[model samples]
Target chain A: MDTHDAKKPLPRLTPDNRAFWEGCREHKILLPWCQYCDRPHWPPGPVCPYCFGDDLTWKQSSGRGVISSWVVVHKAWLPAFAADIPYNAVQVELEEGIRLTGNVVGASNKTLRVGLPVEVVFDDVTPEATLPRFKPR
Target chain B: MRDDVAIVGIGQSEFGRYLPISQLGLGAKALQAALTDAQLERKDIDGLSLHMGWPLGADYDRMAEVYGLEVDYVHQSWTHGRFVTSSLQHAVMAVACGMAEVVACITAISFTRELSILGGPGDPEGMREQGATHGENPVYGLTSPAVGAAFALQRYMALYGATSAQLAAVPIALRKHALLSPYAVMKQPLTLEDHQSSRMVVDPLHLFDCSLITDGAAVVLLTSAERARSMPNVPVYVAGMQGVRSGRSEFIFAPPGLGINQQPASPTTPRERDLAVYGRAGIGREAIQGFYTYDAFSPLVLFALERFGFCGPGEGASWVQGGRIELGGELPVNTSGGLLSEAHVCGWNSICEMVRQLRGMAGPRQIAGAEALQWGTCWGDSVIMRR
Candidate 1:
């Protein structure tokens, strides 16, 4: 592997977050939903973020969302992402009432804008890591 | 504790790179300068509150050893350069409550290298989960501090139809003000065309939109109002100060006034928070002659303008179209060029400038007859300082 490519940071799989990553690896979008509050939270944690309830469940999302905001990063902070300079970083508000950050692939820079509709596409960066990306609907 | 506390002196370390001197050395320099500016002997200080933005600097314990300050009150909290006003509030509370006298509040950043504070996927998951830029931001390449704020600016422009050129005025104007400050990092003039043509770190946020990464430190000496009367220098009273966290989670791309919303927004909005501060101080908007909104990102100036009722929501672009925020304008903000132009000493530089302006000591950039000043962190820390 190229040295810069090797520098990409991978998500550490844990018992609480293993299911979400596994779902992504299988090309499915899974989010943790609080059974107590009946709302979904992104970036899964040990307890329900909203209500602080331990009663949580995972449900598959439709993988559909709209671009609430976005940016084109010209400078690369991490050498691993140097090759991806001038790439688009997008914030997508999923139908599940949560927003996630990812690049808008399969779309040109000029074509990207706020409220752009997109769907998730998982990209396997490493053997153990499959990162989720987004594409124009 | 309103009007009970006052800042007697302010000091700063040389900005930009300081590779030869350690971070502790830089902090000690600022602490000593503050004491000297206040004309207080080393033994006079009985309280200490240290605000370290970057972890590369010395902690409170080590700083005390370096400065030889043994105090009855001591506090050290790591704020991510977002809430230095809260650190000042800590010192004021200590002095007002009689816990200590002659409190020193200092914020120091001692990064000598070109390292960015932007954390990437490599950051501990615990840190990444804190929201703001870290929460759910790793995916979008929201890896850098500038990127998160850039996203917010994009949303604000999209919602309010603000042009990139209008927003560019902020940094350009700040550069103009920076030309007047001896401590400013970028003294060269920044034209609107230059800002527009500059490399885009994140779209709608040009290179000028981002703050400079420099090593610098600023300190403020706080004491009882009664003690301040006897101090050598003109005292800038801490009329009122307030810090509020809206929620545990922070959202970088959220719209203005809504970004970084803490849960239960009873007093989280800037207007509410400003009113709270002004009410406590028994002052109003008419009394404020200087405003120093955090300029970590220029778009924040727009947010502060609207939040403080300087302009209506979505009217910030038009409000600052000309040199409205420049010196001699309606309300001069960040007269020290703020984080954008002056050394990014967190918000301490703003407080320092406010004190000097009130004391009629800020050369060239001083706003004459400046009686009242307001400065704060973008994440909801408001302070009212008066002459």
Candidate 2:
């Protein structure tokens, strides 16, 4: 039996979210802004879900924020992340006021609390994707 | 809402990660069980509705085909946000509106696998691919569901003084009931010690506080009160139903509602999120003998109970102390075990439990004199009924 089929490799990229991928590629995190409310959404909506407005724009983000909350995973589920046994996976409330997730590279579990100070930086795991992550101030 | 619609049949299967069976097989099992309990035939169903997970959920045509159900109407519904009883409310409306003789609803999850929280990538081409298609949730390293549901949980704990134990209670209470329920995914009696010992998923929320990705399905059949009264099973009426969509914009805070920056609107003032639901058909909050809010995440449970008016805002943690939410407690919840221990069949099994309580067929775990089992089918809609 081929282990390739047994292990469902995760998705790389698709058309709908290509803009977000492209935004990340250029070293600028992007969010789909509602043309009506002038607000940005993380899981980009097809339409302005708030005002039912059809118009939307992709806006750049500062990629700066504080850690709202985090967890330290002692176990690894797959090959890609196993090397780093204990990592702080966090939900950072970005400066945009939108809560996006990232990993905390420089903190232990006890040090991570509900409202702690932090900032976002990029970790290029692959040649194409410059992933957003955070560290203590 | 009219007092004419009623639930005449209900069914549920064993819960857990059953990668071996397909979703269709679970649906079939539920169909057979419910049909037997109601003493009705598959040919009796006319109108239909089904709600479940992604990819497997987006395909309405496929569900109808696999079940061999020639439904007159159908709706698969949204995410965990969409409650199960909400579908029952619509089916009740269909029966009341003179649409058909009978309506049936089912959920199948035998093959619905879970994604690793470690940013295991995503399904891009599938219709259920949803919005965030392009990148890695892992590179920055925040990928687990505990962390996904953390901000809101933290906010709830901060505001209400809700402890990790209070959060753990939601799952432990359900695990107790699961021992009584053959269909429940967890059978082991989980103590507060067991609850505390479970590894932390996110800060504050331990693994036990989260819901299991179980394999199972549940179905409910409904018809006019007049028709249900004539059926072999006891009659339970559809009392009242209400559902609303807060423009995805209203809840700018994702998951459990945490704003990354300033909220799209002022966060101080409550914007119609509160009192969206009353507890019941008769006595309101005072009369709801049991509660069945979704417990996919413990903090979500706290927020749900508060938002739905079980307690005052930020008072959920305090009110659930010293076995208050346990099986024999005043406002007994998840008496049949909630999604945390019973498996999240997308809250379908919760609706089944409520209906069984009202019909007085919930053998061992049945609440005494439960005239109605008010349920939340979707966060958008709430269901309240009477005997």
Candidate 3:
């Protein structure tokens, strides 16, 4: 995928989530880790969800996980995706005990299953966006 | 507030697609009918609890203005189906606490006109700064609430060895109920073959598995039990209630611990906290004569059954089979077709059906001596009503 399709919906980066997106742009998966509890939370919240600690750090992840759940959307809910009918979306439980949503490339939709080991692959969909997709390990 | 507040009347507009009437017009029809049913004048309505608002339906201020209702209290939530119970609960609390004398729970939807907001680039909900509550991540083409349900169902099938054939029981039963309902959108009987052969909208979710996108409105009137005694209609008492659950262990479309989104992966049966509504109602789950849930998707019906402990974890697929959830079954659900087969009035249609069942007025779809019914959902909020 190239950086020309401007129709694709991109995540709205914010102060709480900008670091995570910046890390993705650098082809690395960064998670917000609670400095107090030493735990990682998802979606890059301002404070740790578990302990509500304001002191947090962005740590690089292994970008490897097992598919906790997956869905293959058959309908083109978005015109940008109308040509890619039946693409697979998955929730991968990263090794750091958190989950992330992305697509699974380089595999047939039929092959998706719970607990399938996978690793993330970055796709710079646009100049300012690099999506983290997964592939079978 | 068990049995302290009562639903005095229930009314609905004609349910269909692309109705020529505006949302407020549909709301007016239903509100007028509700006032007539309750034998109360519009002046008596001092409170408004609306579950529908901007982008899909009229807001409370607009409804009150257009309907000529001068109210002293108002409760309004975002335009989401999950707030159906919360909206009604607000009405009950308002009336019970004397914040208002008579509260009207109003829901009017125009889904056909607002179809773009359901998904696609036009939908901003999935593209929120922190993601959507229903696991919608549009960046990956995983948009629409249906995709959230599909994600949960696919994982559920893999973990429990359930199949698409077994999931068909939900829509099939609801379709059977719809055939009996005069106001149902889906008139034709749905067979297992139809469900199996329907085109897949998302993996593990056939087109039949999703709820219909249509237009309609429903209204329920609530007042103190003391006032309800003087009304013309039989009062359906608000027996007990619980609010929507949320946390790391909860998913909007799946039972607790089913592990969609950030929910913990450990599978769980219905815990005591989940069954608190029964105890608050001073009744057990066995006394629930019928079940009503937010059946936005067929998998939701199964998840609701499991959420209420009607069946054990992973047992909803098999438990819903063999007409178990149809009328006259072990426990009928959505006796008025629900959102799947009926119009998607944001589950208020089912709430109205519950009132009718409790009043023994549900022609051809009434449960025998229907004394108590439950309006619960996969998300864990519930309101039990009894005659």
Clashes of 1: 7
Which docking class does model 3 fall in? high
lDDT per residue for candidate 2 within B120-216, as digits (tens), equals 4442222245623212243433344444456556655654467887777667777878788767868789989988998865556677877776778
DockQ of 1: 0.48
Least well predicted 10-residue stretch by lDDT in candidate 1 chain A: A1-10
Looking at model 1, the pairs that clash are A101-B140, A102-B140, B132-B250, B246-B262, B246-B263, B247-B262, B247-B263
DockQ of each: 0.48, 0.25, 0.86
Per-candidate chain B TM: 0.91, 0.86, 0.99
Q: Which stretches of candidate 2 lie over 4 Å from their true place?
A: A1-63, A74-78, A94-96, B16-21, B57-69, B78-83, B111-146, B158-161, B248-283, B377-380
TM-score of every candidate: 0.92, 0.82, 0.99
Interface RMSD score of each model: 3.3, 5.0, 0.9
- List the candidate 3 regions with Cα displacement exceeding 4 Å: A1-4
Which run of 10 residues does model 2 chain B get worst, by summed lDDT? B260-269
Question: Quick one: ranking by lDDT, best first?
Answer: 3, 1, 2
Write one digit per residue (lDDT tens) for candidate 3, span A34-113.
99999899868889998988999989999999999999888978888887887889999999989999989888888889
The docking category that best describes candidate 1 is acceptable
Cα RMSD of all models vs. native, in order, equals 3.0, 5.1, 1.0
Tens digits of per-residue lDDT for model 2 on A20-102?
Answer: 76777677788888877999766665776568786888888887777765556554543445555555666677777777766
lDDT of 3 by residue, B132-158 (tens): 878888888877999899999999999
Count residue pairs with overlapping backbones in model 2: 15
Q: Tell me the tens digit of each residue's lDDT in model 1 across B1-387.
A: 778999998888888855466666677788789888998888998888887733456677777777787888887777466547667888999998889988888787764442544454454322343444433354444566777677777877777799889998888878888899998888689998898888887777888888877788888999999989998998899898777444443343232344222211122334464558788888787788878977878887877776667777677788997778889888888998888988777778878889999999999998989888888544556889888
